[model samples]
Target: MSEQIADTAPLGHAKHIRSWGNWAALILLVLGAVVMLFPLVILALNAFKTTEDYNMTGPLSFPAHMSLEGVISFWNTTDFPMKFANSLLISLVVSVVGVLLSVLNSFALGIGRVKGNTVILLFIMLANMVPQEALLYPLYIMFKAIGLYNTQWSMIIIFTIIQSAYGTYLLSAVYGTFPQAILEAATVDGASRWQTLLRIVLPVSWPTISVLFVFFFIWTWNEYMIPMAFLMSDSVQTVPLALATMQGQHTMAATDLAAAALLSIIPTIVFFVFFQRKLSQGIVAGSVK
Candidate 1:
């Protein structure tokens, strides 16, 4: 009877301690979420509040009356749709073109070994070591000399090259272990190298490729420095630059600025909603088995 009571008391105490720990963890998590989301919450609140109310209350204050005037006024002042379209188009092209080149380049370097040409791979690695900003001026001069500066072609090529190099680096490690048995069988059956790659390798790689697509797309969409330096026309400017142009003493008030900021984030939110699953898979896809 005494031993049983001793065990029961300890078990009950442990259970109580665990319950307290769980509650403490939950409270901490809720606090952390509130801290991280506080700015966005403030932004959303101010976005809907009337200018008078926003000015009268602090940023965190609850709106007495919500109004669409801030959103409507923001839409009126800028070419929001056009800027969105530009970012969308650029991001799509960069992801697709860049991933394609990465796959092909990875195959060539990692699997297409013919003459033991390691120097090419060495050069690619060396290129990646240099910061892109270091090459910006030289690239600008070369692009200008070649009459490609300030063109969509220039942006497309630059982003494609930069993104593909990183992609190739990632994918080469995956393809480096291509099943020799399968390749040998394909070759013995009179299947050409291209056929084996197109049929077998590419199909197997689609998941990883999809991940790279999202990665490059997000980077290209958010890229500000390159576009700011090269893209000259206001019509061709991307969403980030367009949002930046909204700032000034006279141009945008607090309410309108908050509204525009919230609106700018909607497309990115939609993008994550669509790609979240595939992206999660891709993150783990390239890991060593």
Candidate 2:
């Protein structure tokens, strides 16, 4: 009894310390979330307010009455529908094409017996490490030469190039988990490489693909730099550019700007709401051999 009490005394003390540590970590997380979310919460509150209400009370003041007028005005000023369509088209096209290209490139590099595959993959990885700012002038000249400058096509091309590298890296990691015996069996059954890839690999790898698709979708949707640099026309402007132009000289009402920001986030939020479960599944599937 004496020995047991002695042993448990240290264990009890350690357990008490661990309990306090867990509580400390949780409190820190809560504080961090509040810090990050406070601005967004403020944005939401002000989004429902008017400029008059904003001026009369304070930025943090609860509204005397909620108003939709600012959001309506924001829609009018920004040409919201056309801007939305442009962003949607660009993001969709880029994600689809980029992810497809990544799948093919990843397969070739991850599973193929071809000579220089590692060298090629190394070069591709190096290409990914090079930042867009470094390539901007060259891309501008090339696009101008090809007559794609200032067009949506330029955004499309550049987005594909940037996104495909990351997608390839992600798919390769997941593909490395595929069973070699299964691939060999398919080859022994007289399946061509393309047939094996299409029929065998794709079916098994779809969960990872779904995750990559959504990841690329979010990245391309939020992309502002390429579109800003390339898309000069108002007709081709994306959501970020549209929202950005609302700042400065055009000088939209602060509340209206807040409203517009909230409005723009709706689609992405809906996407997450629907696919969040699948995202969890995909991540788990990719991780497990």
Candidate 3:
């Protein structure tokens, strides 16, 4: 009986330790969430408050009365609809064109296994590692020479190249591990390389490509530095650039700036919500594989 009690005592102690560990982890996670969410809470609170209310009550308190004046002021001041359209167009074009470019590059390097593929891939990776700051002057000069500076097309072209390099690097590694038997089977049935890629490789790789598309869109939307350098005209400026220009202006209020920020994030939130199911599925598929 004493021996049994001794054995059970250790088991009980282990269980107690696990319980304590779980509670500690839970507390840490909860605290971390609050820390992350606090700024967002403040933003939302101030966005709806009047300038006077925000200054009087401070950011932490609820507004005396919610008002849309700040939102309306920001919208009209920034010509937000036009900026929204510009951001959407640039993001969409970059994501689609970038993914297509990445797929083609990956196919050649990964599945085709072209001569000196490793060297080419290494060069591509090195190119991507080059900072945007380093490229700014050269890109500016080139775009100016071509008369593409201060144009939305310039941004689309630049970001497509930027986003595709990383995509190619990632997708190449994924495609390298693709099953040879499938390719052989497709060949035996008289499928051309293009057909096999379109019907088989693309379908099989859709989940990964979808995730890349979402990421590329979000990344392009948030870009500031490159856009600021390349796009000079208000007509071609994106949401981030617009917001940056609005900052610290004599005419703009803190509540109005908060409102602009709140408005700017709404599209991205909606985009994520719309694609969340597909995103989840891709994540699960990647994990299983």
Candidate 4:
């Protein structure tokens, strides 16, 4: 009876301690979320404020007087619609091209069993080791020689080429783990090389592909330097370049600049919010398999 009571007391104490710990963790999590979210909250609030109101009122305060003046001014002054279109076009094209090249190269390396495959893979990996900035002038000259300078195609091609190496490496590693029996069976069934890859290999690798798609999309969307260097036309300026232009305009208010910066992030935020579940599922599937 004494031993049972002692055991029961400790178990009760442990239960209470665990409950307290859970509560503490929940509190900390909520606090951290609030801390991280505060800037975005402020930006959203400030977007509705007039430049004067934004300057006069504290960042945390409700707009002393609500006005869409800032948003209106931004819309009127900036070529936001055009910039948005340019950014979307560039990101989509680059992501698609980059993923395709990466997947093709990775598939070849993983399944080909060619004698020099390792050497080729090593060279590709080594290419990415060089700093991108170091390659800029040479790339610029090469593109110029090819009549691609200052064109959207120049930016797209550069991004695709640079991004392909990393993507290829990742996809190759993932493909290497796939069962060899599947490939053998596909071959034995008289499936051509293209048919085997298209029907058998790609169907099973959707999760890895999806993850890579999202990664490439985000990277291309966020790319600033390449676009800045290669796309010189005001009409072709991407969202980041447009943001930089906003900074250069002397008359633009700081609040408006902040508001514009916040506006630029909205598309990416919306994309993630919509696709987050798919992205998470892809990640889980890739990691588990």
Candidate 5:
């Protein structure tokens, strides 16, 4: 009886230890989530506060009274709608153009097996590694000479070209892992290169395409430096440019700035939420091969 009791005691103790470990892990995960979310929570709360309340109260504290005055002021004083439209237009155009350019470049390098493909790819990868600031001055001079300065098209083309290298690299890696037999079969069946890419490859690579699309959209939307450099006119200012101007000039209340920042993040968050599953799958697909 004592032996059985001793064995039972150890078993119970083992179970207790495991239960404690699980609980500890759960607590830590919850705490980490809270830490990550704290800034966003603060931003949301402050958006409804008056400038006075925002300054006086702790960021974590509830507002003494809720007010939409900050949001209203932001909307009225700033060209929020126009800035949003400009950003949206720029982001969409860049995303589409960037993806198409990347796809074509990747197909040429990966499937065309063209002479000097590796050398060209290496040059592009090296170029992508160079800091943006390093190229800014030269780009400015070239754009000025071409009369592209202060035009939205200049911003679109610059972003698309700069972004294309990474996108091409990513898509090439993906295409490299695709089965060669599929390409061979298509060729044997007399399917043209364009048809094979459009029909066979793209059909199976939607996840990667979605991932690139979302990535380019987010990058272009949040892009500040390029737009700031090329889009000098107020009429051409994107959302980030407008936000920067607002903050620098102190034309908007602090609460309103917070609100604007939160608003800017909403589209990005929505895009991610909508495509999160596909994004994850694409990442996994890329990593696995």
Candidate 6:
């Protein structure tokens, strides 16, 4: 009876410990959520405020009344629609092309198991480690030489290569673990490598690829330094460039700067929200196998 009582005591104690651990985790998550969301909430509040109201009430306080003056000023001053179009175009192109390149490279390196693939993947991984700052001067000189400087094409090509390198490294690991039986059945059925990739590999691996697509889009959209270095023309500048320009001027009001930031982030927010379900699915699929 004493032995059984001792065993039950440890089990109850473990359950108590687990319950405390769960509560601690929950509290940490709540605090983390508040930390993450507080700035965004403040930004939204300030975006609707006027200079007078903002200065009078302060950033921590709600607007006395919603105003469009800041939003309008920011929109017109930055040529925001143009900036929005440029960012959208660049991000979409990079995401699509980057994913395609990743898929093809990963297929060869991972599924086909090509010669020297380890060396190649190592080089690709190394390329990802190289800071964009280090390559800026060379990229500028090369783009200028090719007459692509100050153009969106320069940004597109640069990011496509950059993003594809990371994607290839990741997707390669996923594909390396692919089921051999499926590939064998496809080959026995007289499907060529290209057909197998198209019909079998691509569909099976799409969840992971979708995750990459969303990441590429968001990453490209948020890029500031590369875009700023490569794109000089105001008409060609991306959303981040425009926002930076707005913030750089000492004369710009706080409310106006907040409004510009809010406007700049809206598209990305919408993009993620639209693809949220797909992103969740991709993450789950990637994790399971």
Best by lDDT: 6
**Across residues 1-289, which tens digit of lDDT does each residue of candidate 5 receive?**
9999998998888765657779999999999999998999999999889888978986778889998887776666668888888888888999999999999999888887778878888898898899988888999999999999998889898989977888998788777677999999999999999999999989888778889999999999999987888898888888888778878877677689888888778888898899899899988876775
Candidates' TM-scores? 0.81, 0.86, 0.89, 0.86, 0.87, 0.91
In candidate 3, where is summed lDDT lowest over 10 consecutive residues?
245-254
* Span of ten consecutive residues with least summed lDDT in model 5: 70-79
Model 2 reaches what TM-score against the true structure? 0.86
Per residue, candidate 4 scores C-alpha lDDT tens digits across 1-289 of: 9999998998888766656779999999999999998989888888778777877876778887777766666666778899888888888887888889988888888876556878888888899898878888999899989998987888788888888888888888788777999889988989998998889878888767777777777888788887888888888888888888777875777567667878788888887777787789888987788
lDDT per residue as tens, model 2, 1-289: 9999999899878765656779999999999999998987888888999899999998888888999987898789889999999888988898899989999988987877447876877777899999878888999899999999988888888989788988887777667767899999998999999999999999888877878778877888888876778888889999888888787437677888889998787777677778788788888875675
lDDT for each candidate structure: 0.83, 0.85, 0.91, 0.82, 0.86, 0.93
Q: Taking the tens digit of each residue's C-alpha lDDT, what string does model 1 give over 92-114?
A: 89999999999988888778873
Q: How close is candidate 4 to the true structure, as a TM-score?
A: 0.86
* Candidate 4: regions farther than 4 A off: 1-32
Q: List, residue by residue over 1-289, the lDDT tens digit for candidate 6.
A: 9999998998888765656779999999999999998999999999999999998999999999999888999899889999999999999999999999999999999999999999999999999999989999999999999999999999999999999999999999999999999999999999999999999999988888898999999999999998988898999999999989887864788898888889989899999999998899899997787
- RMSD of each predicted structure: 5.5, 4.7, 4.7, 4.4, 5.3, 4.3
Name the candidate, 1 or 2, with the larger TM-score value.
Answer: 2
lDDT of 4 at 10: 86
User: In order, how many clashes per candidate?
Assistant: 0, 0, 0, 0, 0, 0
- Candidate 3 residue-wise lDDT, 102-123, digit = tens: 9999999999899999999999
Best candidate, TM-score: 6
* Least well predicted 10-residue stretch by lDDT in candidate 1: 113-122
Q: What is residue 182's positional error in candidate 1, in angstroms? A: 2.7
Model 2, position 259, has a per-residue lDDT of 92
Q: What's the residue-level lDDT of 204 in candidate 1?
A: 77
